[model samples]
Target: MMKRNRSCVLALCVAAALGTASLGGCSVGEALHEGVTAVAESASKAARFDVSGTIEQTTMLDNDVLTVVAESLEYRNDVAYLKLSLTNNTEGTIDVTACTGGYDANYVNDCMLSEGYFSCEIPAGETAEDEVDFSLQELQLYGIQKISVLGLGLRVVDEEYDELFKDMVEVKTLLYGSEGVDSSTFAGSIDSPALAEKLEYEFKAASTTAPDLAETDIEIPAAFLFINKDGDIAVMAELRNNTEETLRVQAGNITINGLAAYEGESWSGGTVAAGKRGVMSLRLSSVVEYGDLLFDSSKAAEDADSTEGKEGVDLSNVKEIGMTISTKDANGNTISDPVDVAFAF
Candidate 1:
């Protein structure tokens, strides 16, 4: 599959981060088309969430009137992502122009997705299976969350979407009557019972135990899942830019939950610079056992018996992970042939 344009996506991130009405005042629907060439590309990043057989948060709305399977939610860099499939078994097509993924009882905070319709459609009896990338904005990336939506009515259908946001950021559709009356309504929040359930369901996915990654020009040579010396749970990857040209790492993410932010400003796995070798440290959202995060192929045989009898922590839970490293050159051309790197502990 081909990748989406990167420059356009970063532009949207800048607009959303700045809270501009039109991608910094370019107008809502227009922004989605222009920037989506970039954002929609992240869905390719969705493959990183392919936890094979793990069934995470599978919830139904109004007894399957709308069923949603939140296949997985992982934290990469500073973004909170929800890779899900929502089926609309209701009466008519529920056009979700925009969405607010509300994670709390009170809708005070959320990862707002105004360009959702560009990515998918739940046209009555159909399912929209696309990964949603939510900007952390003011929310914590590692917490359990829900998806919500709001949008507009079309008088003049734009190439990007039906209508514009008009700076209306409310989840008004949660009230039901607002759907067809000129604009979109906020789909009501789906409240879960407990936080622990949210955490377990969202992150439960099939993962690799001992990763054997193929070689790439940009490679993650050494990976570790360990409590850093500073006492924070961390995923440290030593990335090397084997290419001779100065390939800039456009974005970096280690999707395993925990580790809210990447350690540095430029590269998450430390600056790859023009040279080939460097280390990138993703600070975990929370702390984990020192041993579990430190396991790999060679050490597994020795630690197998030692980790089994250990109480309190479950070493089996620390599954292997897939790392995504995107890079580009001076000509704005993307470096291709991506191979999965592993932090198989």
Candidate 2:
């Protein structure tokens, strides 16, 4: 009797699976398909951190030559990623130096020496897809409502445009900063109003008002020298810690005489032991046509020697080196007020 009961049960299960009975009436193929589909849907949901509804498209122009379009910015695994594309319409390449990525208005960059992105080239008459990545795990931990990426400048490398000011190739910035249009020798005209506007922007930024570091506790115990040696110009200074505690001095967004001396890199800055001193310097390199100068201190140590007490350092018609050096604490939080130390030349 028991064997008869077991045989009846087995027959009923086979009938249901074969779709011959009303008990859930599913075929073997149908059951297999449904099970696989359910598993796939769950795995698909688990794979992605959804930002489909969060991203927005943005368009930015780089000196009227290159167009940068950014979209689908998302963060995962401590890296903030952006889908960016560049279309270069002009006849030259665009030297994109940096892309300032921030959360809300907060610049996630702790030390001003953030190389947002560099050495990335966009050739003319070409469209290229670029991926920009930034590490922002701390920002995520603190929480973020929005993400913004800006502060991008492109150096247009065109032979035609460069030829327009061949006479000013070496001393263009020095001339412009010292004499502006009055020094008509280097201030040649560009037919493109857009290019003119961009030049004007750079000029204004590089030669802004001199900073007043008097309000801050930081001090430069020695006179800073703008030196010329080995075909390189460098600024050497001593960062003196006036505070009772140690200081991690950070200098970024550096500009000199209305031009970018150094951006996206620390300029003449470092840590000073409690009431002690540290070396701060910036070694500069750039095309002079842009009517500005920049300083890179992170690499200044390599070029620091042979510049000490160097008599050949030129200071003619000099103005100021606009910079902001901040003092950071043990937790990397900015503990003191920003030190706007625009060393006058």
Candidate 3:
């Protein structure tokens, strides 16, 4: 994939980020048309959500320099769309940048739609509008429904990508008749057939030791479960953070059946916010390939005759899995000693 520096032509930068044909020095209108076409093409199977036209006009940002409004909400397949209208009130051009952020009870805070929509500039006294798409199915998989609010954290920057404001601006828009969120509405709902089958099997693993609350400030409320997504198995570790700081959780020194397994990092776990529950998922096929496990290839080569037609380490032979779970604070400081967690087949 080709990448462009921020110093490049703004329209071309946006075109590259949006995966659209280069629009050299084109106006914002032309770039927006091309970007929207790319988005629609990426989601060719998506149908228009019925409530798109009913979204209330919510003001996201308003100031002497810029005014932003959440114009509407729409759905493209499993992705949610938030159309924004930005007016540059200042004498100079400005750029708005946004990315995926955390979510709360009311809304899935941020979406994957950044860079492309706001990478271009809004000229002085001119209004630029576009839609940003985010994953709605991921939220549905977590058993959350009846959304009434959508939040966005945006950053205002100058044409040179320098910060124009001191802090990130957050905006929330209401949708779906202001209904409250309820996880019980669809607790076990899964869209993929392979994932549904794994759920029926009810695959779960138990930890042998408990985490020290004084040190870790976290609790495991549920057993680690095997989640099959697109034919890949990811071990889901659910954690509830009780402290008032964001916790970065990861696994190391991992092993399967007493043999070293994939030791690569799985960022699906990411960061869990304070006083909130989140998932730290470790996919089995991290370094090698999906549906394949790490194993002793030298030993396998020695038994080539018996291992004929065998692809990877068989899951049936995986009797136990072990790892050291460590955590860090928001400042990248180690919060607690690594805890060794083990699970038996």
Candidate 4:
């Protein structure tokens, strides 16, 4: 009886395979139909620009046709300055404009002129030098975590006609930190094979601990947590053991916008040693959309202070807003309890 049962199973499997093969069988006519369908789909969508050009960096601006290369960048306190050189290659005169656009440490819009963008016109066929400056406060306000120079726009004009050049040649540069002052200049010619090279910048990672704040002895810092441009909410807290002895601790819980913390898949866990500091990074998934974390001008204006006859109030421009944190002991006991960090904008 066992042998008969095994035979029946094998036969069923063979029959199923045959049925599947029959359903998937394709004839010559079917293949031709599929080819025509694919051709029609491809023909419906096409690109508008023929992006088959090259990019290069240069240091000399005298040659009418040229690209600018950033040679050095430095930041002190909160101000940042970028030094760059331009080169001209064409025999005829070429007019050019350049600028910087990217994010700062706080991931805010820390572009040139606080607008996170810059533009400057270069004299025809003349290689010029220039610098772009920005504030650290503006960088932190926008949560700008990175910066880079993408390309340039050029315009050529004659008595009879004029032409606008957009991204004519790509210029690549290495982003160095404040420490590295003696570095090679980023420059090259357009359409050259060497223009494909990219300059890399180094970043350092660091962390710090805070003083413990228990229910009876807790003192909240005068700061507000906000939503970041990446749609993440962050609240920083310090924990310190005032007592002489080390205290055993466990994970702290946080609540925001009526939603409980430690409920998401990206939850953090760890222990805090006595006299040592720890950080808690939390996100408010329930209250945030993908790109709504950054400060919006409309929202800030609506929440601005409305005191009569007084100077307009400026709330903290938070990259990440509206967050709070709470702590717990090793025995699963509540700490100072969770508190909401109010957001004004």
Q: Give me the overall lDDT of model 3.
A: 0.47
RMSD of 2: 29.2
Residue-level lDDT of model 4, residues 1-345, one tens digit each, is 000011111111122222211111112222222211111222322211111111233442233345657555555543455455655455555444422211111111111121213334444455556654444332222222333332222333332334434332223334323222212111111111211111011111112223344542323323323222122223333333443332333323322322232332223333333333222333333223222333233433455454411222111222223333454453445654444343221
The segments of candidate 2 whose C-alpha lies over 4 angstroms from its true place after superposition are 1-53, 99-115, 138-154, 159-345
Candidate lDDT (C-alpha), each: 0.33, 0.37, 0.47, 0.30
Find the candidate with the highest lDDT and give its number. Answer: 3
Look at candidate 1 and tell me the lDDT of residue 95: 40
Which ranges in model 3 have alpha carbons more than 4 Å from their true place? 1-55, 61-68, 86-128, 153-210, 227-230, 262-269, 287-312, 316-319, 343-345
Model 3 clash count equals 0
Tell me the number of clashing residue pairs for each predicted model: 21, 12, 0, 44
Best candidate, TM-score: 3
For 237-263, candidate 1 gives per-residue lDDT tens digits of: 444555566444433333332221122
lDDT of 1 at 79: 50
Residue lDDT tens for model 3, 1-345: 111222111112222322333432311222212211111122223222223323577787788877888787776664566777888888888866553222111124321112222344677888987776544434444444434445444556777766664223434444444444433212243322332332221244545454454566667654443422122334555566677766766666666555555554432334555565554455454522431354556544464455631444443333556677777775567877667677654
Candidate 3: 10-residue stretch with minimal lDDT: 1-10
Error of 4 at 6 (Å): 82
The TM-score ranking, best first, is: 3, 2, 1, 4
TM-scores for the candidates: 0.26, 0.31, 0.56, 0.26
